[model samples]
Target: MAGIYIFSDRADIAAEIVGFARAAGKEAFVMALGEEAAQALTNAGADKIYAIDGDSELIESYAKDIAEFLIKAGAELFAVGATPRGRDLAARVAGYLDCAMASDVVSVEYHDNQLTCVRMLYGGAVQEKQVLSGLSVVTIPAGKFEPAQGESTIEALKLKADTRVSIVETAPIVKEGVDLSKAEKVVCVGMALDKEEDLQIARDLAAVLGAELGCTRSIAEERHWLPVESYIGISGAVIKPRLYISMGVSGQIQHVYGIRDANLIVAIDINEKAPIFKAADYGIVGDLYEVVPLLTEALKK
Candidate 1:
């Protein structure tokens, strides 16, 4: 039987992985970073839960400790969410274990003593199925699977390890407004915005709607209109929001990669042939200079 590990901060996701493991008739373990998170995983039906104990101040050191424990536990398949922290932790663990690692996997199945993983590539343009060899580490995309449910026994295990490093300092980066990752609504602008003055129209709409502002690579990197961190594309941030408003975005494959998880996509571009129209739930063919200001005014009043 294969051993599955659920790596997550949220109990609900851990529960889903537990359900998947039970369905596959595999022994599952939940690894969390905190006590409260561990209990939540236990409630979700993990057979075993391992909580890493340390000051929240030393994240890298704690991650290394957890990685070592997972390797020693003989976990056959390690799974983590594709979130920023999850990705970093998984990579570190995989590197330590000297195993192959895959990211953005949406589904996994084991048959005939081999684990098959399905992942999305090229901004959701293609699905690739890979059969991992040896010990495998995988980072699953969020919101792709259901959490485990039902009554199950939970056991907390204690692990001992030596710390090789210590945290020297910590500081928070202060910024005004909401983080784009946590924003409920997002307004994205693209190269089709034409002149820099037109960007104000998009910003005004975002302010009126209480939404975070995002842009494609061209607008952010080339024009320097938005910060590089605000670029949303395959090479940038992957966002899943309740509402995503696209203004003058042509919807290139790279840009679409980041917004595939949006529940609602509204695309506005004068070019009806723009690729984004195909993915948009609502499409408007018009000049963004006129369309955006009208939208801003409408949203304001």
Candidate 2:
């Protein structure tokens, strides 16, 4: 019987599931698309590798085969990353297994034949805990768990590929930003900034603190000052940094949800009653245009 099965085209995310499986007190068996993915995941600590060694136009073409194989193997839990491709594969597998599935699960525990899952609802405004009985599936976002390392054996699986779908062309979108989910310190800007040029103040502070730059939804979507990848919120990147600093952010609940786990939060805004102050450990009620430069200088000295 398979303990817990994990799947992701990306080895790093699969390794994260490996960490999650081990933390939940189960051995991890991961689905590897090709030989390299299998060996890379095993090198990263997966105990068992369900190796699907072949070249295909698309990895998702094997979803049907994977679902059937796991069901026949008496798979207990199927954990998948919440990437676009991962979500599609997870839904297809759940449909085939005829089992309940949880999406964007932040936490899960398996104890005494029970699987309890915790996921946020209403854009981080609420958390719902559910218990699923027998052969369930779940999708989790990255950066939730640290990657685990171990030794593992590979089991070869040959699947019938889907002939219906074919890729015509592929082009990766160019993005300029760090993966904020993994950053230890983050400096975020918000709508309080009136112009793109004003981001320099936030950047200066980030450079001094050795932190990555982040932004609220408006700064990225509405203003186009930063890439969507730089946004931090329920709809964007959720982060848990050791130190999080916000400039000119009004601190809506959606934005706060992303940084709530930070070890320390500091907010700088002109309004004394800005909501960001409520969620911050330290609130500076002053114009960010004046406050940030001074703070950066102080940190330098």
Candidate 3:
């Protein structure tokens, strides 16, 4: 009843969430897809490894297998990564088991023999805290937990993936950029600058601070000045850095939700009353065009 089953198509993710199981003081079994994933997960601190016998490629196909094992083992909780594939598989398993599910879980607590999960609600407007009674599944995002390296045993099972859907073709999407979630210092741009050319101002600041560059949704989605991966908001990247300095970002709740976890949030905007100032640990009221260049110079000294 205290066993925790962790599953993720991505090996690193499965490893990352292992800390949660360890913190709960439960037997953690990690699901690895193939030998490659199994090798990557050897340092995941798992008590045991449940690997699919073959390189199934489509993790979603094994939804039934995963759901069946949880029931057979009577696992108390199913911890899954919140990636697209992970979400699909978790939903399918939830349906099969008819168990309560929590998505986008940011934090978890096992107190007094109960599992409580905190997740965002209404586009990050409020946080919903849930307590799991029966067998439950929770989807966790990256950077929420860190994994420690350790030895574990690998156990393989025959692949029992669903065959109703076939994968005709698979192509990898290329995304080139820093993983802002792991950044220590982040300098984010906003919609305030006059033109694309003005990005140099923000770039200069990031260069001086040795920080990763991020942006508002419009800077990447609509204007296309930066790649989609560079944006941070409700639907974009959620970052937790030591220092998050947002330049000219209007600080919509959607945007603030992403940066809320930063250790220190600094906002620079022309308007004194911008919502961003309210959320920032420190606020500077001035035009970014004037403020950034001076700030960059100060950091260089």
Candidate 4:
């Protein structure tokens, strides 16, 4: 039987890929770049670990060598996390290997020696199921799967350095607060807000719940109440927080598309017939101005 291989620079994501392998009744062999990453995979149910003993910078900068490695290793299925950088690397690897590939996969199944994946299409509006023939590359969506657990044996692999991209000083964006994309809880405000000062309610509630604050396109782009980074919509960030509480959001199709993946949606709006109610798991038909303060106080207590 051909072996299943899971690869990712992020240990947490690698853990999730291990989970996927377990769920499919397959053994997960990890290709790790560092000692810490290999240990993480071992603890998270990697059956075997292939450790690369060389300049880690070269692997992170180039996909060609890794693709060649997988192709030569006779990997039946290769998986990685579906982050921006991960997606880019996966595409290059797929191209180099000339293998079938899928991205942002939320579900995976291996049967009859074929890989089937369920992912979103058309900006998360529709779901598509695809089955791959022969060797394939798949990118798992982060936070979508629970991690697996077990111990593993580690082995060393010789480096194949073919670095094409050179790092020119890394710089971090000077933004404050949590990354809303990964936030477990999020509180978003929208056009229903009356004044810029009204945003204090959202800020206070977000603080009380220890959640990230987000807003609609109009609030971010038009009023500029919050930074563009905090905007959640078709043109903004797509999030899948566990608890997403939207206050005064009208739930336009584009806006709802951004939050469709959230586990639980609680919408608070004065308009009883607002479109948001259709998408909300729970909703309140009351003025947010009065409701937010009370909610915050309750959460604090």
Report the number of the highest-lDDT candidate.
Answer: 2
lDDT for model 4, please: 0.83
Q: Candidate 4 at 230: error in angstroms?
A: 2.8
Which portions of model 3 show Cα errors greater than 4 Å? 143-150, 297-301
Better of 1 and 4 by TM-score: 4
Superior candidate under TM-score, 2 versus 4:
2
Q: Compare candidates 1 and 3 on lDDT and give the better one.
A: 3
- Local accuracy by lDDT, each model: 0.78, 0.87, 0.86, 0.83
> lDDT per residue, candidate 3, 1-301, as tens digits?
3499998877777877888788777889888777677777887899888778743578888888888888888898888999999999888889888999998787887889888999888767888898988999899877678774588988886778777788899898788777888899999999997799998998899888889999999999889998888999889888999999999899999999889889999999998989999999998999898899999999899
Ranked candidates, highest lDDT first = 2, 3, 4, 1
Q: How would you encode candidate 4's per-residue C-alpha lDDT over 16-112 as one tens digit per residue? A: 8888888877778888876666776778788888887665454454567777777777877888887677777788788888889988786888767
Q: Compute each candidate's TM-score over C-alphas.
A: 0.76, 0.85, 0.87, 0.80
Can you give the lDDT of residue 296 in candidate 3?
A: 94
Ranking the candidates on TM-score from highest down gives 3, 2, 4, 1
How many residue pairs clash per model? 4, 2, 0, 0
Give per-residue CA lDDT, model 2, range 44-112, as digits (tens): 687778778654757677777878888887889889998888888888888877889999888877766
